[model samples]
Target: MTLDPEDSKLITLARAARARNGSAEGAAVRDETGRTYSATDVTLSSLTLSAVQVAVAMAVSSGARSLEAAALVSEGDPGSADEEVARELGAGALLVAGPDGTPRS
Candidate 1:
């Protein structure tokens, strides 16, 4: 499927994050101003966060008041928390892609 250039960029960042970190999931988000943040899942003994959740946190911490879009690259679907966080931040859509960077959801 054809994707907008910016959206495609998000997927590329997410895919790279996954590959670089050897993580199960990766995610990227674009803020209202077009700034983007990317992250991999965080799995620690005391804390765990989805890739999308981490990406949202990065955007928020960077002073982004709202989000434009989000992209998640994973073998499985994004969890409800991931979707909710993005929505709460005013993201228009949380696009989903397979590990291979193929759009799936």
Candidate 2:
């Protein structure tokens, strides 16, 4: 499937975040206002959060009321939590991409 330029950019950002942190996943979301947020998975001894979850939290904390699109670049598929957050923010679909930045599902 062909992705919009902005969506492709989000995938790039997500891939970079994963590379930088050497994490299991990376995610990026574009808000309705055109702002973008990116994050890598958070795996701590006491807590764990997926990259998509963290990205959504960042957008919400930054006062973004809605999201236009979201991308997850990871080896594994995004879980229900990721989809739920994106849906809550009004994102119609969650773009899933591989570690190499190829859009998968």
Which lDDT values do the candidates have, in the order given?
0.93, 0.94
Query: Candidate 2: where is the Cα deviation over 4 Å?
Result: none
For candidate 1, write residues 1-105 as lDDT tens digits.
888899999999999999999999999999999999999999999999999989999999999999999999999988888889989988866899998889986
Name the best candidate (by lDDT).
2
- Reference-based lDDT, residue 94, model 1: 84
RMSD of each: 0.8, 0.7
lDDT of 2 at 4: 95
Per-residue lDDT of 95 in model 1? 94
- Residue pairs that clash (backbone atoms under 3 angstroms), model 2: none
**For each candidate, what TM-score against the reference?**
0.96, 0.97
Worst 10 residues of 1 by lDDT: 85-94
| TM-score (C-alpha) between model 2 and the true structure | 0.97
